[model samples]
Target: MTGVVRLATRGSELALWQTKWVVSLLPVPTEIVTVETEGDRDQERSLTEIGGQGVFVKEIQRHVLDRRATIAVHSAKDLPSTSVDGLVVGAWLPRANPFDAIVGCTLSELAPRARVGTSSLRRSAQLRALRPDVDIVSLRGNIRTRLTKGKGLDAIFVAAAALERLEIQPPVVEILDARVMMPQVGQGVVAVECRADDREMIQLLSALSDRETELSVLAERSFLRTFGTGCSLPIGAFAEMQDGTIMLSAMVAAPDGTRVLRGSLRGEDPEQLGGLLASDLVERGALALLSASEGKG
Candidate 1:
């Protein structure tokens, strides 16, 4: 809080919202350094085609690495599962609604073979499982654009956190439950990253950290890292606190939703619990499901 903290972030509305949220909680003056990422530049292509979860984060982290900024703010879900050398996620803000929302129409309202838009493999696969008759098409862009975009589609799927953060409640939004379509790992969370050597800044940022949120993140992303995958794979995990222990549920599915392997595990150790859940999944042929898919999942 003694020095000016420059925050590097993607130049998107949702990204900015997450950045400012981090800034507001800190005691230091913040300078927003907006970076136009490869992901931002190419909205029409699927995320897997570009670079999966790392597409939006690498450039922003470059600013921090090169001393252009002090920290990087990102949607937690956009981050890669692997750790980056010389950098660490110092803190996480309190999580928000961690689920997907169907915008512009209800799930059952769309006609058979009705065109639906989404870019997430997890969402697309789950949607296909829910309604095999509907056509799932690739659609990309910001929250505003996706909500208004046309691909002869009946509706678009988006994160519930984005809409709620942007104060957008489209007339036909249907909040999909985690039971139906499990959420992406780290969804609805905001992460703040800093250089490994920046002790002062890391300590300051730690003050804003919520321990429960941090534990949930540890469990969720532990599964991702142990599984060794990122976005683009049809995988989903959601971790939450039940009473005092951490309860984790995860799913791995075929790209076409023909087969889904899922399991849950609960314990005190977040990391161990996630790892155990993943082991259970692998025993249930999750490795086959993961191997069948290409790119990061």
Candidate 2:
């Protein structure tokens, strides 16, 4: 809490922007230490093939664990549901637009067999469930790279928060409803991780935590955690506080989108609400869909 705090983050444009935002809020001066994660190194391979949930965050966390950085900044969606033993998320920035946006064309306007690009299995499964005729191409990279690669495709899915953070707006942007596409856990939140035993650092970062955002993200993450850590299947969860109660919605689907188990639950305790919702889905055969997805993997 005295000298400059080193922040570990990815080198991508969005990652830098997110880290810079954290720096702006910190009381102490900061130094950003950009680390190349496996996800950033191998953009060609699907995330599942490259190690799924933690692909973008493990290396960044390592920087903090090694004391190379005081904290690790990450797009919360990149983090796996399981907590790292030595690292802890100290702060949750205020949530942004927790919705997916379709660029280039509206969902309804796409022709049959139109190619749509996205790397997220959650998005792919939901899109397939909605438009089985369209092709879900494997597309990866930063926001700009994905936009550029989607030139010939009918459309591409991007997180609405990413575009908003970078202030880039395409000519055609259709924000998908949560009902149409439940967002990934922690989708629009920024998480700051630090050494769990570093009391000073944890205190400094915790001061910046947003209560409402923290609760919602906690609920969503709890829902995903019930499924297990490092789960790469097509699953999504979103939580919001309504009238002092937490309302959580989630979905589990087959990779081909043949079957999707959707459910919602409400409770005051975020963790309990998430667990109840996930348990309900499992009882309804969500585990079968997860097993089928694992078989494909």
Best candidate according to lDDT = 2
Compared with the true structure, what per-residue lDDT tens digits does model 2 show for residues 1-297?
A: 589899999999999999999999998888999999999999888888888879999999998889999999999998999899999999999999999999999988988999999988888889889888889898999999999999989999999999999999999999998899988889989999999999998888888999889999999999999988443679999888899888899999998888888999889888888898999999999988888887343
Tell me the tens digit of each residue's lDDT in model 1 across 1-297: 466899999988999999988878888788999999999998877888887769989999999999999999989898998878889999989999999998777887888788888888998888877888888878888988887784357888999999999998787889988778889999999999999999998898898888888888889998988778777789999998999999898898888888887788888898898888988888889888878887633
Score every model by TM-score: 0.96, 0.98
lDDT of 2 at 187: 90
Which residue pairs collide, candidate 1? 230-297, 233-297
Question: Against the hidden true structure, what lDDT does model 2 obtain?
Answer: 0.90
Predictions in order: lDDT: 0.87, 0.90
Candidate 1 stretches with Cα past 4 Å from truth are 150-152, 295-297
Error of 2 at 48 (Å): 0.7
How many Å off is the CA of 43 in candidate 2? Answer: 0.9
